[model samples]
Target: MGDGPDLIGRRLREVRAWRGLSLRATAELAGLSASYLSRIERGERPVERRSTVEALAGALRVAPTELTGRPVAPHTPGESEGHAAVEDLRGALRDIELDAVTPESTGGLRTLPELRHDVDRAAAASFACDYRCLGAVLPDLLPRVWAHAGRIDGARTLLIECLFHAFYLAKDLGYRDVGWSIAGHLHRAAEATDDPAWVAIADYMRAEAMVGAHARTRALEAVVRSADALTPDAGPAGQAYGMLRLSAALQSAATGAVDVVPDYLAEAADISRHTGDGNFGGQHFGPRNVAVWRVAMAVEVGEIDRVPELAEAVDVEALPLGRRAWFLMDVGRGLAAQRGRETVAVDTLRQAEELAPQLVHANPFVRETVADLLRRARRDAGGRELRGIAYRMGMGA
Candidate 1:
């Protein structure tokens, strides 16, 4: 949906800023000229090839999907059919069985190596926000992954891992039903594997998806039950566990249980001391991630002043573009909510729009936030850009 060249340019700029990188520094790191980088950020240059996108993502410490979005062809049967496809996909998952899945499911040789290759690529696609490709591929991918649902092989374990990312794609797309399906599959896979860390991840994602439903109590129960799933010495698995704990804290903040939020935050902070910053549960979880969550938590509690304070303590640039962009959205929102900060807030939102246009545009909360800004904004100056975004989201009536 983000077809304009400017969308990509804005992402380049927003992510660069999040990482605390200057235009000159990022250009040097990506082996491009400052002028070109600036142009790309300004939407003047056409986007690059996958290799170039990958290079830029690497230099910026983000997944390719953050920059490229879904690599949809002109005729790709997505966007228009996304809602229906989700329902159809759910039906497929509902009917799957270990006995039913086999070599034929893959349309060719379904060897472990080949299947894993596809699984990895699918995970990458989810990170890249290639929803159309992911939606197109999942009908096949799910069955193959489900084939080993109860097995304890590496593939079986990876099934949980793959499902983890799959759930992410679903959640980001606002298909919570699909996310719950992914979560159910992961729960079964984690139970099958009997792996502590994987189990922690399953519990974590469950809590994550549940928060969207405003089932704070259910989400709280989930993380609490997984409390002993891993220790700090468990490496990424432990970090994953701690990350879930942090998620629970965010959930508490959402419920306005400010008193309980700090306990969960403290526990997660302890876990982060061991793992620092890491790619756990396909999400960034570390001390800095904890700090980032604090900003979001502050926004959740309507403590706008605290949001910027917490934000400055964490350098978002170290996060992947997807995560970095998400964090910035909160910052932008917090700024927008404060008196006399509407102008800065609009600029912040613009940065967020550039980083992940669909994520910003498709989210109802963000739309409402922008709508509120519009109601309060003046007619001239920055209002023009805000109005343009409102029109795209079909909001500024």
Candidate 2:
């Protein structure tokens, strides 16, 4: 469905970026040139030499095959009938002609003989995770995808998306490395797709993972780069809104760039409002969605004083349950700053802790921010009460 060259380029860029290597650095490490690598991403140059691909993949710590979206040729029967839909969808995702993805002419995008093998391998690894099998999945999936490097149309995008979700699922289930491994592939997929905006998005998410690792400076840089990459006409409104929200939140959290927070929030709000219910690419951001994210950003920027105003400015109660819980966490955090006494902090934090598990989905910043605050408060006060709260939230005693 998706073109092989485009898919390979995207995967290559994603892997290289995730490894944090500059084009020059990657070239030096892999014995390639920065200019040549750029040509590959732009799809002006082809990486047909397996030695070159293997070297690049090795440098990026990805298997060579993962860079190539087509691992093996599709079965004739699979290609002709039932697999038409899958192939078509894959083509659309690949955007084989460098134009916008459309419903028509999207089939037969994947012709890579190698990528097919890796897909089966990655899928098998993903399924093996059901048995709490991190070791099996990691070994089965990562290497194959990494080694089979090249463009195979929409397969690259789909594969990386699957990998990201798989890793996230593994992380939520308490396997951190699996999540990290999946996240590691985001950059390559974005690259092979030849979309700068998606590259920025992948970087932003990578930075988010770094934040969880407490790599604040790296996270901040990632967010700023993502924001910088925005070209106004990048894509649909919801995508832009999500990026804006992330940029502002990360800016505020990572650098104390508090002054920019309001502007960022306002920009995201404006986009959401104008977009008319966040319907971008068939996805909706809804009023509640924007408001909840805004609240979280406001809290992170120490704009706690503005929390009430923002809350009143939007309909918080009308949001999704996950979002409502997030808002409650924000409100709880904001209430912690009240002048009266430490009692308010304790009470508010308790609510935050109570609402935490739900907030963890789709919002990592809230969890990290709350955890850090609770840890600091406990250390500052040396109080059993604060320590107990952190323990209950699994922030680790």
Candidate 3:
């Protein structure tokens, strides 16, 4: 594979140049320093935060994907299959949105229980980060759910679950537009159910989808509002409420509002104490999940030093595969940023990849960090391992 231009940095420089804006001007617009933006464009720094990418995109009047290079080309057969499935999903979503789905084309309508089983299977695949299996299941399952949604009780709930699977799959695969479209479908389906809690869940998903685009402030505000509207008790609604607080915490950290981060975390922690561990709405909330998000939030806000302490408190073995891998990824990212910790960083990242190859490889930050490590690798020392990781991430040897 060709050594492509530095992913986000190269795109940022090109877009800035095309717009005929000086580095200082763009920096001013994006509320960043000229020197910092210069380093980012020169590939001396990786654009690690989604908030930063969104800010730059806003300054340039472009979608965040323009900088992130999302919907990144499939590098493996499994990824290729996943991308192909997205095309089918796109058509299905379009047909559903337009009320054009035909029963004749969608095969016989599936019973609500059968549809629920299919959604459960998809959720399991998602929790395992098995995008290929999820991709295989959703294209056919979605249309059938849509068919049954109007005719059966509780079918719309199943449809919402299918949309959740679709949303996460698309987002994980870097199809931001598809994810956003699916989020819209999710919001509508939840609204149709007339449950404020489900609507709150959809609102949380929508905020997440928005973070991939522009409007970081809007996303954060929406989450906070939705979270405030819900009462924190024990059960699915409580879990949803806790998750919304977690989302707000991360978004705040992303925007450098560190002071408020702890408040949100504390609130979520309290709610988790009541709710206990849960898989409600596939969110995996509770004390353990909240602990995982604490580590993630620390990483997001550049509190790299706290990551080790926060990470140590969580029992990774108890978390789902995807959560475990992501927490490890965050740990790796934190370790990689510290001086004299390259070896540990590499090992942690490798562990994450070993647990879930799809999640690790799909992460742009991991690819960038591995490339940076490879650049500094001594031939006799860490070079071999870094090369292996780079090759697996399709960054070349």
Index of the highest-TM-score prediction? 3
Q: CA lDDT of each candidate?
A: 0.68, 0.50, 0.84
User: What is candidate 1's lDDT per residue for 278-300, written digit by digit as tens?
Assistant: 77668778887888888777777
Name the TM-score of candidate 3: 0.95
Can you give the lDDT of residue 342 in candidate 2? 44
Q: Give the TM-score of candidate 2.
A: 0.47
- Candidate 3 segments exceeding 4 Å error: 1-5, 212-214
Q: Which tens-of-lDDT digit does each residue in 131-226 have in candidate 2? A: 222233333333334333353355555555445535444443333343444456666677776766556556655654542212455566656656
Arrange candidates by lDDT, highest first: which order? 3, 1, 2
Clash totals for all models, in order?
4, 50, 0
Comparing 1 with 3 on lDDT, the higher-scoring candidate is 3
Error of 3 at 223 (Å): 1.2
What would the per-residue lDDT of candidate 3 be over residues 163-219, giving only the tens digit for each residue? 998998898878888998999989999999988889989998998887533366778
Which 10 consecutive residues of model 3 have the lowest summed lDDT?
1-10
Clashes of 3: 0
RMSD of each: 15.4, 17.6, 1.9
Query: Which residue segments of model 1 deviate by more than 4 Å?
Result: 1-78, 81-85, 97-99, 148-152, 211-214
Candidate 2 stretches with Cα past 4 Å from truth are 1-153, 166-181, 212-215, 234-238, 241-245, 279-287, 314-321, 336-397
